[model samples]
Each structure stands twice: as C-alpha cells, then as structure tokens.
Target: MSDNLARQFLLREDVVFLNHGSFGACPRPVFEAYQGWQLELEREPVEFLGRRLHDLLRAPREALAAELGCGSEDIVGVLNATTGLNIVARSLDLKPGDQILTTDHEYSALEKTWAYVCRKTGAEIVVVKVPMPLTSEAAFTDAIIAGMTERTRVLFLSHITSPTALLFPIENAIAEARRRGIWSVIDGAHTPGHIKLDLEGIGADFYSGNCHKWMMTPKGSAFLHARPEVQGLLDPLVISHGWTAESKAPGAKGAFGNSPFIDEIEIQGTRDPAPWLTVPAAIQFRKDNDWWGVAAHCHALAQDTARQLGELTGLAPLSSPEFCAPQMVAMPIPECDPLVVHTTLFERYGIEIPVFRWQDRCIARLSVQGYNSRPQMDRLIDALSELLELGAPQIAAQG
Candidate 1:
C-alpha cells in the first residue's frame, strides 16, 4: 500500500513490475531467513541432512499446515506446484477408457503433463472450453460438470487461472466430484497468499500450492496436500529411501513410523531444504504486515487499472471483478502482435508485464503487489496508450 514497502522487496527501482503472478518477489527479511538456513546447512552438511533434517522441517511444515487448515501429516514441501501435481499425475492408474476432465484455462505446462500421462496410459483428456466473459459461478461449474462421463476418473481444475486471471468457484465442483466418487486434484498455485484457503473445508482429495508465488517465500518453496484416505494411492516422483523402506519389508516404516507419504515425498535425496524451511518466515512476514489489508489495496489498484485499460481500448474485461484475482487482472488489448507489444513495453518503456495471445484474442495482464502504487499503474496505462496506437489508428489520432 505504501511506496516504502517497495523498498523492502528485492525488485529493481528502475522498472515497473506488473508480473508478480509469474514469479513472486520475496521481501528482504524472508530472504535473510532463507539464506540463514542455507548457511546452517552448509556449515554441517552431514549433521543437518542426516541427523536433524526431519526435526528441522517439522516446525515449518506444521506452521504451513496450520495456515492452510490441514494436519501436519497431510502436507509435504515440494519445489513448486507443478512438481507437486506431477507426482499426482504420474501416480494415477489410468485405464484405456478412463478420462481426466479439466477446463481449457489450465496452465500450459500442466496441460502438457496431463497430455503425456494420457498418451502413455491410454487415458483420454476431456478439455471443456470455459466461456469467456464469464457470466456467473453456476455457469462455470455447470460447464465443467458437463464434461464428466461414466469413465471420468479425475477432475482437475485451477483455483486461479494463469492466463485468464479468473478465480473459478471450485467448491461446488469439488463437492460434485466427491459425490460422484472421482478424485479431485486442485492446482492452487495462485491461491495461497492471494486469497483465503481452508483445505479441510474445500475437501479436495489432492491440492498443490506455491508459497513462493503468493506467500513471498524464496523460490522452490511449495506444498502438496492429500487426504489421508488417498495418501496411499500416490507414489513419490523419485523413488527414494522411503520407497526402499516399504519395498524391503511389507510392514517396514521410516523414522516417522506412521504414514509413508510424507517420508517418501519429503526425503528425496539430499538437496537444499532451506527453501522449505523458510516458509514460516514468509508466513510471519505476511502476519507482521496485515496481508489482508495489503491484498485489498492491491485489488483496488488492479481493478482500477483494468477498468481504465478497457475504457481506453473499448474492450470489456474477460471476467467480472468478483471472479478475478485480488492482485491480477487480464485486460483485452486491441488487435496487435502480442510479441511486439510485450517486447516494446519492456525495451522502450521499462514496464514489465505479460502481453500474449490467449486463443484468438490478445490480453495484457497486470499484477499489483503490496509494493505497487497508483503511480506504477498510471505509468503502465500511459505506456500502453502510446504503444497501442501502433495497432489502433484512432488512438494515434487521439494522441
């Protein structure tokens, strides 16, 4: 809300950054905490990794679980949301006639991941096209529910869409999946810090979120949560010590002596657990500064900017304000080369935002964080007004 908050982040002062949805900017205090963990790891690699690693991760995992409204056993830290979802996608037992139903608004990488899994397992991917200029939550839920069939095995959906920047009301969909005895996998990469999340209330079988994106943790800090009943169905992406322990003896268990899910996923060979360990610090940073207040301020700025952009281009917004993200909005830009528009905004105006083609239309998405102010929005609006003239003749005449 304050320009002073911008100085606490590691972002550069010379450029206007409106792409926090892609990769988030971490604050100075959180980064210092991350580095401290790394330093501790380096000082005693064997003692840290071999001895105290489990104990070290316990507190942060508990803290994150408390924040997410889930049990400590339900979640384990991972690199990112994609990695967490990959574990679920790769572990499913898909038959030739089985189908995975999802919307077209999913992230591109996960789209490829599902495609590859289906190709290998002989499963079908039923992609439902969610109508643009979204009317209401009931309509969106109905669109997804229509894609279900007798053979539909899994229902996948994003909590907040990557390109469209729309927040799908997934509670009804997840409840429907439960009623139909289907596995519900939620990709919540953009939800954790941007909006309120209650994993227990949502009741999704599997959910993955990125702390690095919205929670302001260092890169590679993310989490995967699975219901206790479904935990046994998932196999770790990498077969590690936990897997070996289970394989050697039918009833053999790891140090946890409880569920094998956390042990298997959390103890993937010795790498830096520092990123995962700093999650509490990131959560604390948000609490230290009233994050809900910051989110409200950023949402107002984003909505105002999108409204101005739509007025300038004479194009309506993709989704209603209630359905959009708190800090991010996708504005429909005039007909133009998306690549040229993206490059010119960065190279010429020092404004960093994403302008790309989503299906047949070009959209410029703006992301406003706690550090962003009204001046940054005005700068983007001015730069866009000048550059968009190249695509629209009327704008040039007005200028």
Candidate 2:
C-alpha cells in the first residue's frame, strides 16, 4: 500500500523524503487539478480574474471551512500560514507596554513577524518555556495560561509546534485567553490534515493554517480565520479594492459582497489562485484514498522508527506519544553539529530530513506520510547508526 501510494506523489525517486512536515508533497491528481486552474486563468485572464474570481474563490473556502468546522465567511485563503499570521499580527492595535505571550517552540518565521510588529508597535514578546519530555496535557495548558498577565494582549501558539513536532493542548489556554480579553492567535501550520481540527470549537479570536503542509495542496495555499465579532478589528495587509469605506462601517457588507473578513484579505491583488483552488481536490483525494487509515499506518511506522532511534541514541523523545504529532516525531540525538548530521544524511545516504539545534538539544525531525515505508525507515536507521556510531539497539522501548 505504501509503495503504491509513493507512485502517486511527485517526489524524486532517488531521495528518501522524510520531511513532509516542512512543505508537503502534493499528489499527482491534486497537482494536475492545480495546473488545470492555472491553465484556465491564463487562457482567459480577464474573465477569470475580473468577472469570475470572487465566485470562483468561494468554493475552495467553503470546502476548507467544512473540513475545519468553521463558517465559510470566517476563513479566507492566503499564501501560507506565515502570511495569514502576519495579517493578524500587523492588524492588531497593540500598544506600548503590551506583551504577546508565546511558547519557545513556535516557528522561527512567526517569531520574527512578532518581533517586527513589536519594533513598530512597541509591544513586547513574552516567551514561556514548555517543560521538556512533556507528558501531561494539564501541565502544558497551565504553563501557557500562567504566562499571561495584565499586559498580555495576545496568546500566540502553534497547534503543532514546528521544531519539536509536539501537538499542544491549546484549547483550554485559548478559552482562558478569551476570558481575560487576550486575543488568541493559533498558528496551525502543521495542523489541518495532520490532525482533526474544529476551529469553531477551539474558539480562537484568530487562527491560521497551511493546506500545503498536511492537506497535500500545492505550495502557497493557506488560510486565516477570524471570528465574526472580531472581524472588524483586522485591517488587510494590503489596502486593495476590497477595502471600501463601507467595509469599515459596522455591519456593512464587503465591497465584493462577501464578509469584510474574506473580501479584504483574500482579494488582495493579482496573484495565482490555482493552489488555493486545488484545496477541494486535495480534500477529495484524502477521502477517496482512505487517508485516515493511511494516517494510522503512517503514525505506527513513525512511532516505531522513533522508538528505534531513541534506543540507538540513548536519548529520550521530546514528548510522550499522546502529546507528539501523529505522523511527525522530533527524535532527540546525541550532542553533535546539526549541520554535519543533516548534510551527511542527505549527501551520503540520499535521505532528506531536517536536523537542527533547538536550544540545548540536537533533533532529527522525522515526518511520515502515506508514501513512506519500512525500508526507508530502515535506511534512515542504518544511516544514523553509521553517522552517530551507535552499533546496535540498546534496548527496544515502547511509548
């Protein structure tokens, strides 16, 4: 089954691609659908972009909203999670002495975005260190909530952390933020198809996620979601045609007839909506392929591999199984140069994975998709054994 699924992806045959969590690989059918949209746009540019774009864009948003369990009007397509997050970070009317509380495990790009926002707005960023080897959800939630104070304006967090690949229990924290009048902005870059999502149930003031990562859409497909009551607070990153005087008025409809939240951010400028349009095809692909079953198989394989690596390196996992990502694991490694480990794995073994130093630990983050197989995992283990000089398994351990 894994071998058959591998053929559907466009990944290179020579490389053992273990980095699906970084930028997802689009399946052949979905990529074809993406190209079809691009062809349609080019064949009749004016008609597609001018007369039909508003309606054309609506279908994908509705499809995505259904999957995310949110109102279609609350979510708008954006280039990536980072772009969607930037739209929210910049739009907030944060004042001097205000603080944005966030975890240390956030994606670096978003950290930089908040820093830029801080420089301009005089808002400060407060980092909370999530305890290592996270085994308790209550502990995780408590740590985040404890970070908030009188001046904490926004509670920024990753639904699934990028570097560590831990699935944070953010629901309680989000609810607490709402109670305290601190806006909750969730970065769901590794969420979406990676895990079950209910944006409305989560009740965040703002949320953003990438379809390109877990939804198997082409690059440049992502979304930002804002609740209806707070939609007026956001100003679009670009003051495009969607920003009508009427949009600013309370309870007024958008210039494009959609809600101001959708029209203002989605209708930014002339750009390829092909990737965004391919979202339905991607969602359909998952259903047709029984992706939940595939995901389960991938998860078992990923955890098994993580177990093997942990035994070999004599290093524990960053989190317990319940808190770890379903299909991605950040395996702790013996202290070494991260760059050397990454380069050697790629150059010598033709294995593509992300190895990096996150604070005190060296990590090799493994992402298992439907296409990955036991042999590829074996190859990774073999390579790492040679690289790290760990001869054999010390003792097989279970989560």
Candidate 3:
C-alpha cells in the first residue's frame, strides 16, 4: 500500500529518503498545479497579478483557514515559517529589559532572529531547558510557566520542535501566557498536515507554519496567523503598495480591500505566488488519499524504527511516544561526529537522513511519510548498524 503511494511522489528512485521533516516531498499532482499557476502568471502577467490575484489568492487562504479552523482574514501567506516568524519578532514594541521566553528546542534560524531583535531592542532572551525524556504534559507546561517573569513580554514555543521532533503540549502554556497578558508565538513549522490543528482552540496570538514541510506544497509556501485583536500591532517587513494610512486606524480596511493583516504581510512586490496558490491542491490531495490513515501508519513505522535504532546504539530516545511528533522521531545515537555519520549514511548506504548534534546529544532524526515503506526503514536500520558498528557483539560489549 505504501509502495503504491510512493509512486506518486517525485523523489529519487535510488535514495531512501527519511528526511521529509526537513522539507516535504510534493506529489506530482500538486507540483503540476504549482507549475500551472506559474504558467498562468507568465502568459498574462498584468491580468493575473493585477486584476485576478486578490481573488485567486483568497481561495487558497480560505481553504487553508478551513483546515486550520480559523478565519481566512486572520492568516496571510508568506514564503516560509521563518519569514512569518521574523515579521512577528521584529514587529513587537519590545523595550530594554523585556524578555522573550522560549525553549532550548527551537529552530536555529528563529533563535538567530530573536537574537537579532534582542540586540537591537536590548530585550533579553530567556531559554527554558525542557526536561529530557519528556514524559508528562504537566512537567512540560510547568517548566514553561515557571520560566515566565514580570519582565517576560513574549512566550515563543515550537508546536513540533525542529531538532528534537517532539510535539510540545503547549495548549496549557499558551493559555497561561494569555492569562498573564504575554504575547504567544508558536513556530508550527512541522504541524500543518502532520497533525490535526485548531488554531482558534489553541488560542495563540501569533502562529506560523509551513505548507511545504507537511502539507506537501512547493518549497516557498507558508503562513502566519494572528488573532484579530493583535492584528493591528504588526508592521509589514516589506512596506509595499499595500500600505495605507487608513490601515493604521481602527476598523479601517487595507489598500487591497482585505484586512490590514492580510494586505500588509502578503502583498509584497513581484514574487512567485505559485507555491502559495498550490496549497489547495495539496489539501485536496490529502483528502482524496485518506492521508490521516497514512499518517498513522507512518507514525508507527517511525517510532518502531526509532526503537530499533535505540536498541542498536544502546541510547535513549528524546521523548516518550505520545510526546513525539506523529511522523518524525529524533533518535539518540552514541557519541560520534554527526557530519561523518550523515555523510556515510548518504554516500555508502543511499539513505538520506539528518544526523545532527543538538546541544549535548547527537541525534539522527527520521521523518516517515506516506511514500516511505517498511523496507526503506529496514534499510535505514541496517545502514545505521553498520555505520555505528553496532551489532550483537557491540551490545554484549556495552553490557
């Protein structure tokens, strides 16, 4: 069944891809839709961009909003989650001594973004070290709530972390942040199609996610969602024709006749809107294929593979099964050079996976999509066993 689904994707035939979490693989149908949008744009550039663009863009936003359980007016398309997050990070009226509280498990790019923001505004970054082998929601939420102080102005967290691939139980934390009047920003870079989401239920002030990673859209597609009340606070990272003096006034519409949030963030000049436009096709593809069932199978396969790797390496996993992302697992490995492990796996075994060092731990993160099969997983396990020199003898020696 999985093998049948694999044929729909455009990944290389030879390589075993276990890195879908890094950048998602789009199905042929969705890619075709992306190309069609580009062709339409090129054939009549002014007609497409000038006259039909606002309405054309509206459909995808509405589609995505329905999936996320939010109002279409609340979200605007961006190039990626990083771009959306940077807009939020840079827009805040942060002052000196204001602190941005976040976890150590955040993506490195956003970390640099906040660092830059802090440097410019004299705001401090407060990182909470989430306890390892994360077992309970109470422990996770407690650690986050405890870290917040009077000076904390923003509470940022990853819905599903980049490095660890752990699905943080952040609902309680976000609620707590809301009660305390701190802005909550979620890096949901891994969430969109990987897990079920209800953005309104989650109640985050600012949430951003990538359609490219899990929704199977083209690389540049992503979005930032802001609650209606806070929508007025953000300034466009790039001020374009969308900017209007009336947009600053309460109850005033944007230059493009959309909400100020949508017009300001999405109307940046002269860029390919193909990826963003392809989102509906991707969403429809998922619906037609029963992707929820495929996701369940992939999750089981990923966790089983992670267990196999843990047994071979005699190392513990980063989190319990419930806390781990549905289709991605960051399996801990023995002390070794992550670069060499990554290179050897790709060069020698035809397996493509991300092996990286995150703080004190070396991890090989595996992402299983519908296209991946048990045979491919077996190949990954065999490759890791050989490369890490792990076998029955090694297990006995360690024992």
Candidate 4:
C-alpha cells in the first residue's frame, strides 16, 4: 500500500516528503480529475462557464456537504480556508468596543487578517495563551473562556492549531459562545479530512476548512459553511454580479440564489473552478483506499517519531498523544537555531520538513500520510540526532 500510494502521488522520489500538512500532495487520480474539468471548461468556455458551471459544482459540493454534516445550501466553495475566514472577518459589523477572542495557537495569517480588520474598525483582539504541555481539556477551555467579556463579539478559534498541532476541545467554546449570544467562527483548515467534522452538530455560526490540505484535493479548493440564521451577516469578499442580482427581482436570486452568503461568495468571476469540481474524486479516493486505516497507521508513525525525538532531546511533547493530531505531531527540539537544523536536514539528507521557532521554543512538526513509511520516519529521526549532536554552531557553519 505504501509503495503503490507513493507512486500515485506526483511528489519527487528523491526527497522524503513529510510536509503533507502544509499543502497536500495530490494523487494521480485526483489530479487527472482536476485537469479533466479544466479541459472541459476550455473546450467550450461559453457553455461551460455560463451554462454548466453551477450545475457541475452541485455534485461535488453535495458530496463534501455530506462529509461535513451540513445541507448543500450551507456550504460554498472558496480558494482556501484563509479566504473564507477573510470573508467572515471583513464582513463582521465590528465597532470600537467589540472584541474577537482567540488563542495564541492560531495560524499567523488569520491573526494578521484580524489585526487588519481591527485597524479598520476600532475592535480589539484578545489572544489567550493555551500553554505548552497542556494539562487537560478543562484547563484549555477555561483559559479561553476567562478572556470573554461583555464586549466579546466573536469567539475565533482553530479546531487543530497550526504551530502546536493540538486538536483543541472547541465544543465547550462553541457552547459558551451560544449562551452569550456571541458569534463563533472556527478555522478548521486541518480538520476536514484529518478529523471527522459534524458541522451541524458542532453548531458554529461560521466554519471554514481546506480540502486542499488533509483531504488531498488539488490546491485552491476549500469551503466556508454558514448556518442559515447568520448567513446575512457575511458578504462576499469579492463583490460581483451576485450583489446586483437582487435588483432584477424583489430579493435578487442570481444564478445561484438570493441567499447572499452562498450566492455572493460562490459566484466570483473568471476564476478556475477545476479544483472544486474534483472534490468528489478526492472523497472517493479516501473511501477506496480506506483513509481511516491509513490515518491510523500514519498516526502511529507520528507518535513513534515524537517518542523517539523526546527520548533523544529529554524534552516533553507539547501535548499528550491523545490531544495531538492523529497524523501531525509537534515536538520540542533542543534549543538551537531552528533554520540551521531545517537547512542541514534538507541539504545533507534530502529530507523535506519544517523546523521553526514558535515563541521562545524551537519545534519541529511531522506530517505522516499514506505514502510515508517507517524507514522515512527513521530517516528524519536519525538526521535530527546527527544534526543536533554538532549543536547549532557546527550546523550553522555547514549551512
């Protein structure tokens, strides 16, 4: 399975690819599906784009909707999760005293987006720290809930954090937000395929996730899910014909519908919709290959890597194995120039991975997919052991 799956991907054979969490490596089948859609669009631009685009997207969207546990109308395709979150952040009716509460473990790009929005509106961003070596789920929830105040207009959080790679207990946060009548916006970029998502069950006002990452879809495919109640609160990031469509009729049901949230956001002009049209194929790929079994195997590899690294470094993992992502784990590395180790591993060993400093600690994250093998995990473990032996000084010189 490992050898065959590895061959199915377009990733180079020479480099050991361990960074699937960053941007997913598409399988040959899915890539072909993406290209087929593109070819169909090019064959008859007018009929494909003008006549068939909306209908062509329906099946894929419905397939993803079932996986996400939402109705077809609740979800809309976007370029990526960041763009979906941007649409939510920018559309919010924030005022001077309003606050967007989140944790320190969020992706930096979304943090910057909120910062930009705050700069425009006089809102405040309160980032609470969910400390390393996390103690318990209650403690994690308490830390975020403690920051909530009367002015807390929104609760923004990551379902699976970026740098820390911890699967946060967001159900508590979502429940609390509902009780307080505050909006809950969840960034679930790493959650869609990595973890089972029940959007209707979770009940977040706005949810965004990326299919291009863990789902192994072609890049530029993602979704934004808005509950029917709050759909009007969001406007499209790129305003187009959907905005003006309502003028033709009383409520303006454009090509898609009068539901401004899905219609406005989904009908962006002159963009390639090929990646989105291939979602069902990616979903089919997962089912055909038994992705849950693959995820379990990959998870064992991640935990093994973390345990081996922890034994070598004498440092504890950021969270327990239970709280860590099944296929992605973040472990603390011994104090060194993170970039030096990152460079040494890639140049000397032909290993592709990410090592960086988050806050004051140096951390390396490992992402294991179906194609990864035990030997590949050992190669990273062995390379790190060799690199850290020389310390950052020798590693820096070699770099």
Candidate 5:
C-alpha cells in the first residue's frame, strides 16, 4: 500500500512485534528528530525551555489542533493519556453519591483514576457491562445510555479500549449526555495516529490520547484536549508556576487568564519538553508518507492475522471484520492461563505479543504497523499451529 520512505519504522530485530497498539514503534526519521530536539534541550537548558519552549510546544499543538479539528486553546500537551485523564479526574468536583458511569471494557489505569476519585469524593463507579461478541455501534451506545441514572455525574469511556481494542461510538453518547447534563470524559489512548480523530465531532467534555502509541512519536509524547466550557472545571494534577495568573510566568497560560482548568493541569514540574515538542515533526513524517494508505494496509494484515489465529486455535473472534477494529484485534484462545500463554509466546518463541485475561475470556491482541509484513504474521501462525497441532502442553513438559 503505502511504500513511501516515511513508512520506514525502526523496530528491534530478533522478535516478531505484533503489539504496536500497546506502545507504538517510532519511525527512524521521527526517532532522529526526537533525539535532535533532546540534544538541543541539553545544549541550552535555559534558552530552550525558558525562552523558546512555550512557542515551540504551541506550534505542534496548533498543527495538531487543525488535524483534530479543534482550537489550540482546547488542547494541552500532557505526558501520556493516563496523565491527561488524571488531570480531568482530579479536577472534577465530585460530591458524595455522585456516579461515574462506564463500561467494563475500559483501560485499567484509567479505571483506577476514576476509582481513586470516587474513593475521595464518595462517588460511585457504575460499571455497565457491554455484552461480548459485540456486533454493532448501536449496541454499544445503547448499553451505555441504558446505564445512565439520576446519580450519574460523569461518563468515562475509551475511544479505543486497551484490553479489547474496540472503538466505541461516542458521538451519540456525548450528545445524549449533554442533553441530560452529564459529563463525558473519553480516554482516547489508542486513537491518535491510528484512526481519524475529530475532537469537535465527539462532543466530549474532556478527551485525552497518546501520540506515542499510534502516532509513532517518542515515549512520553501525548496530549489532553478539553472543550472550552468544560475546561474551566479542570485543575491540573500538578501545580507549578502556572498556579497564579496575576503574575504571568514563562510557563503561564497566557492571554487566557485565570483559567483554573488549564492553569491547574498544564504545568507539571519541569522535565524534558523535547518529546512533546517533537509532535509536529512526527505529524509531518506521517503526512509525507501517505499515512492513510499505510493504515489500510495494516488493517488488512490485522484481519488476516486474526483469521489465521482463529483457524488455528478454533477460538471465536471477539468481533468480525466489519465490527473488528482496523489497527488491532482481540481474539480468544483455548482455556489457558494468560500469563502462561504469554510466557510461552515470548520466552519460548520470541513472539512479542499481548495475551491478557479479561473476565472469563483469554484475549490475544494483535497490532499491525507498517513495518509488519505477512511473513511476520506467518511466523505467528506457524508458532501457534505448532503449539496446537504438535501438542504444545506435552512439548512444554519436556522443556
């Protein structure tokens, strides 16, 4: 599909990496750019952060805002999706008996954020279970909407769930939440750089995502985008010089004065801003590479890999090709402990994959990046076929 040089990724050898959805593999050029910015930061710590970091950081957010179809004021660069969610989680002034509604398929770390908030504020976390072997967008939306009650104050969801890798239909949910005066905070950890993102369209009060996972940026590169009206409600998880607007500092939220939402969350104590600043470069690298075509190609591979694995394992897939996510697929395997299966894949076969236990089912999540070839998928298929057909349990005993 996309045969451009920009599609070139520098993944490590000696292992078949099919877990890009967990943490994205940075492209060679983007990696170089990340290093270059890091070098500049070390070269002049004072000038780089004090004099130039604000505008330098803003440029990428501006470009990314355009891509995300939201104003730069609505988006603030954060360390990761977890960090972004924490900002919103801490800022929410939840009271006792208030409810935060969410589905069972949410990311664990994000769930922890809400749980911690609930513990502090006496808010109840209402978990609505969306039936598995999930079929349509309507089914997902309806399940969540049905869970809303009078006590529901916040609705937290994953744009692309980490455990299942399914994309939720949030627009209708967000629109409905607004009508009922409920807050919708989405954890879009695997959304950016994987699928097309429209922050305005989602109508979410707060949205946070990671650029490192799918955008192919260096680690610690991510952002949190919030709506204008709701932004005032957020307090940064970390407080620094940006706490007071009366006297604007170098890292202060300029022009937009006394916005406790942004002021409270945006400035964490000084660390290297190099990764955050390198986002524009990563965006440019993808643009030059015809990223759309690459996505299509990767989706095809995901479909094929899922099919092969399913045929070999005789385990039903979580979703079919139509409902199945393009970049990643979560497939079930035979009755086996996940950690044991995972160790067999990695330690025994050197297959870098994610085998996780969720509820009653065991899931094998496969992610397809540009660097992944059919041969790589073939390796996985062969390994699995050997395990199943050759009586892997018996083979394991001998080893």
Candidate 6:
C-alpha cells in the first residue's frame, strides 16, 4: 500500500508495526482531530454532552448511517462492539433452552458474552467449527446453516473474524434465519473500514462494528445498529430512568426495558465520549484521503503479505484469498510461546505485530494500512525467517 502513510503511526521508531487489527493505528491528522474533539469535550462538558448532545451527535450519526447504509435512528454509538453485543445478548428475551449459534471465528470476549447470557437463561451455545483451507463462501454458510435447529433462537456470526480474518457470508445465512425467525446478531469488529457493509441489506436484527479498528479512530469508538421493530428487544446493561413504567418509550407504559431512543447504558454515570465524537473527524479524514482506494490497496498488500509469510514459514493459511479480509490476514506459526515471539520481534528486531495462540495455533496477524510498504513487509519476512529458522537454533542451545 502506502508505506509513508503507515510510517505516520506513532510506534517505537525502530519497530516494523504490522498489528493494526488489534487496536488500529490512527493517522497523525486523524489523531489531531481526535484530540481536538477531546479538547472540545473538556472545554464545556455540559454544553457538549448534556444540552446540545443530540444535536452534535445527529449530524455524525447521519453521516455514519449513510456510509453504513442504514437509517440514522437505527444507529447508536457505544464503547465498543463488546458492549454493543452485550446490549443485544442481554436485552433479547432468550428463553430457557434457547440456543445461540456462532462460529469458531468469534472474538473471545463476545464468546464470553454469549456464555454469560446463556448462564442467565437456560440457553445453549452452539459453536460451529469451521475447518481450515476454506474453499468457498457456500461451504461456510452451509456448515453454519446445518447446525441450526428448532432451539436455535439466535445466529451470531462475525463480519470479519478476529483470529482467522475471513469474511463470513453472513447475509446469506441471515436470509435463511429470517425464514426461520432466528435473531441474527453480527459482531462486525474488523469490518467498519476494511469492508463495505450495508447493515440494512444484511438484514441482521442487530449488528455492531468498531471505528477504532479499521476506520482508524481513537479507541472506544463503535456503533450498534438495530432494526426498529426489534430495537425494543435490547435492554441496556445498566438499569436507569428508562426502566420505570412512567419513563418508558411511547410504545408501552409498562415497557420497563431497553429504551432504544435514549440508551440508558450510554448515561453510565460519566466518561469520555471524545472518541465517539471523533467519528466524524475519522470519517472525514478517510474522505479527504480516498479511503476506498486505500482499502483496495491494503487488501492487495494483505494478500501479498499472507502469501510471503506463508511461503517463508511453510504454514497452511486459515482461509483462501477470496474468503479473507483485505486489511488483515492470519497465518499459522509454529506452536511456540506466542509471547516469546511477540516480544522477540519487538524487543530485538523492532517488528510490531500480534503473535497469539488461538484454536491450538499461534496466529501471526498483520494489518495492512496505507502507511505500510513493501520494504516493511520484507523486513518482517527477513526478521521472522531469522527468528523462526536461524534464531531458533541459538535460543534452544542457550537453554
């Protein structure tokens, strides 16, 4: 992609940073914009968040909704996708013995959310294992659909997986869920700026994504989009004024549940909404810099990086090129201590990347951004070759 752009990220100067999927690298300009919003919030918290809050949020929400292809009312800013998913998982009146079906590719935090919801209600978590070397989108959809049953009340899938970095054809699965009246809750953590999303077109009951990941905003910026009909199904994690019969929305006096319009969870006492407010600045930054083209270029580089790394390491990829995300790729590494390698790369070679163990594998996930360049990838390749092949010998001898 654009090596110079990637260079703008404030990392240890010597490090060849590749792990954008974990938290995202904010461009210098976007970060400055973020700080500006933070300053604005600090300037007059009451005027910014209390009185003129909705008005300030409205324009940004409209802009984001237009980009995501949904109505502005359908979207609500949140801390992150984890909180967003919790709002949906806890809000929905999942019955005893109800099942929440999800793929093996989900982020661990959300998996815990599903487990928590299951523990509260007598619900079952049906985690479908998607085999590696993914052939096509149909193979994935078919496996997930095959797992569905009468008790399957929910279909929870990731837009782009955390560990595997593959894009699941969740729309097709959701279409089938609609036929069976199953609630679809999509965790789109890696998809906001990485891939094109049409929340309305996907027809998921509830979908949440992070701007801090792919959109390159300050951390703690994310959004949840819920269909109006099912919006009432959400119960904000915190109980507040919206819980009382008198305080309920116009629909019912005894509603006593999630107020979609005024999410009480949002009023969680007090915190910084600076990152959330920076949504417009982040989006505008992308607009000012031809983001779609940046995405396409990043995608190509990700594929290239995956191939180079896979060839160098002699490891089988988690998924085919067609199924994987353009921004990030996960290639399996030797089942060694992930921390050792992660630290080794950073401390020794100055390569900033995520090396973590997941599903009995150590995945090296590299995030391609506009700032990354061919030389950076080459540096990664050379350093990893040294770490895995040449360096392994010496490290073992020392022991």
- Candidate rank order under TM-score: 3, 2, 4, 1, 5, 6
Worst 10 residues of 1 by lDDT: 390-399
The sequence of per-residue lDDT tens digits that candidate 1 reaches over residues 141-191 is 999899898899999999999999999999999999999999999999998
Q: What ranges in model 6 sit over 4 Å off?
A: 1-4, 240-259, 262-265, 393-399
- Residues 202-272 of candidate 3: C-alpha lDDT, one tens digit per residue: 99999999999999999999999999999999999999977898887989888889988898888889889
Candidate 6 lDDT over 1-399, as tens digits, reads 555665666665666778889888888887887788778888989888776554565665777898899998788888899989888898888888899998888898998888888889989999898856787778888898999999999999998998888878788899999899999999999899888888999999999999998898889989999898887676777765435544445564322233444445445546777777788888888888898998888888788877887888788888778788888888787656677788899888888888888868888888888777778888888888888886665544543
Q: Rank the candidates by lDDT, best first.
A: 3, 2, 1, 4, 6, 5
Which residue segments of model 4 deviate by more than 4 Å?
245-252, 396-399
Better of 1 and 6 by lDDT: 1
Quote each prediction's TM-score: 0.96, 0.97, 0.97, 0.96, 0.93, 0.92
Estimate, for each residue in 146-230, the C-alpha lDDT of model 2 and write its tens digit.
8999999999999999999999999999999999999999999999899999999999999999999989999999999999999
What lDDT would candidate 6 get against the real structure? 0.81
Q: Would you list the C-alpha lDDT of every candidate in the order shown?
A: 0.89, 0.92, 0.93, 0.88, 0.81, 0.81
Q: Which of 2 and 5 is ahead in TM-score? A: 2
lDDT of 5: 0.81
Pairs clashing in candidate 2?
A: none
Worst 10 residues of 4 by lDDT: 245-254
Clashing pairs in 6: 3-372, 5-371, 6-371, 15-350, 91-235
Candidate 1 segments exceeding 4 Å error: 245-252, 255-258, 391-399
* Global fold similarity of model 5 (TM-score): 0.93
- How many clashes does each candidate structure show, in the order listed? 0, 0, 0, 1, 3, 5
Provide the RMSD of all predictions against the true structure, rounded to 1 decimal.
2.6, 3.7, 2.7, 1.9, 3.1, 2.8
